[model samples]
Target: MRFVRESGLYPDVPVPEVYAWNTTFENPARAPYVLMEFIKGKAFNLVVRDDDPGLLSGLCAVPESQQVALVKAMARLKASLSKPVPFTEIGSLVVDSSGTFSVGPLMAIYGVSLGSPYKSIEDFWRASHEQRLLEKIPNFCARTEESFQPSERFTPHDLMDRYQKLSALIPYFKIPEPYTPLVLHHPDLALRNIFFDEESLLSDDPKVACVIDWSGAQILPLMLASCIRIFRGHRYTGIVVIK
Candidate 1:
């Protein structure tokens, strides 16, 4: 959020102030930790009733007006960040000794291992599927073979074959030159991660005070980053992108 704050795009929106942080396990905290500002605001989910059944009508418990305001606020944030920051490669953001920001090695899964920074979208996509086929599938198969029924368990060969097929289709999914620039993408932008003033729900325009939990954010191609994510009952329906 240092990046967002420095951009000067969201004057009304405020990210937490980091008092201190240790990114290493050697710290007294015993694990990596950040001491940040505690903003007083309600999460987006808190504005609605838990038992409300409005979702069945294709609307969430939030009133239609509030929903519109929420979308507007979030869209502005998304658009603002999408512009100011642009990277040549796809990777996690990193700060160097001189406090200069750059794209760094990507954490494929919970930082289990850092993959080389990808200079192109094709490289990133290819490495992702290759890793899944070569490592993830084999690891999963070995871990689950003893507990799961044979019919239910996926063989490493079968899973790898499926991944290989998906990998082969990468060319067809390529974005044109216009939308290929790398932009930051928040891996999780659920309502729970968005905060606003409770009183703002009564107004026609509710401002998002903060957006938290940006752990796995990455710089991705605009065609992938600009995709809209729909929220179903309690889960995200994944990103939907239009050419």
Candidate 2:
């Protein structure tokens, strides 16, 4: 949050001010928590809706003008975030004891239980593929003590063989030059995570006031980071291509 703020890329997008936080469960809260500024605004998802006025609301009902405006706002945010920071290692950003920030071991979800920082993208992907083949595949294939039947069409051995072949190809899969740099990416940048004033929808310029839920934010390769999954299945006129 501090890095993005200091970059002055998308000044309009306000990141919640973290008053306090505990990354571990050792604290009284007994869970990782961040005490941040309470942002007051309407979520983008609820703001856009169809004409039916039913319980379900989405972008289906939104005006073309509003859709373009909102998409522009989202694009601006993504463009600013795509700017590369000075990170030599691939891992989650962390604060040190001396109040310095740097890349640390990757968080458990992305790595093998807080895996060490990777020097190269190839190393990162290789380790990831290996983890899936060696650890996760075996665990999933393991037969439970209770009588159990395999629901999958392919047998456990077939799955293992497929993964083994896939893993062997990891070394040959090269990343493009442009996507070599690592950049910070929000794990989820969907409309539900964005907040804006209700009034913005009324005008040509729709500004996003706040972008919350920074959990699981990562320093990822540019190619992977550039994707916003929400827009994948969207079918609308004048669909702006982001790239």
In order, the Cα lDDT scores of the candidates are: 0.68, 0.71
Clashes of each: 0, 1
The TM-score, computed over Cα atoms with residue i paired to residue i, of candidate 1 is 0.74
After superposing candidate 2, which stretches have Cα over 4 Å from the reference?
7-12, 28-31, 48-56, 108-114, 139-153, 231-238, 241-243
Pairs in clash, predicted candidate 1: none
Question: C-alpha displacement of 190 in model 1, angstroms?
Answer: 1.6
Candidate 1: regions farther than 4 A off = 7-13, 47-59, 84-86, 108-114, 136-169, 227-231, 234-243
Q: After superposition, how far is residue 127 of candidate 2 from its true place, in Å?
A: 1.1
* Model 1 residue 202 distance off true place after TM-score fit, in angstroms: 4.7
Would you estimate the TM-scores of all the predictions? 0.74, 0.78
Give per-residue CA lDDT, model 1, range 1-243, as digits (tens): 666566564465478876676688998889998888888887765554547643332236556665566666667767755754656777887776666778888854366544758887778778877876666654675565566666775666678688878988987877898888777777676666788777784466776678887665677777777754436653333332211
- For 1-243, candidate 2 gives per-residue lDDT tens digits of 655565565575688777788888999999988898887787766653455554545565566776777777777778878877788878777776666778787775333454658888778887777676666556655675243455655656676788878878877888899887888888678778888877875466766778887766677778878865455467555767554
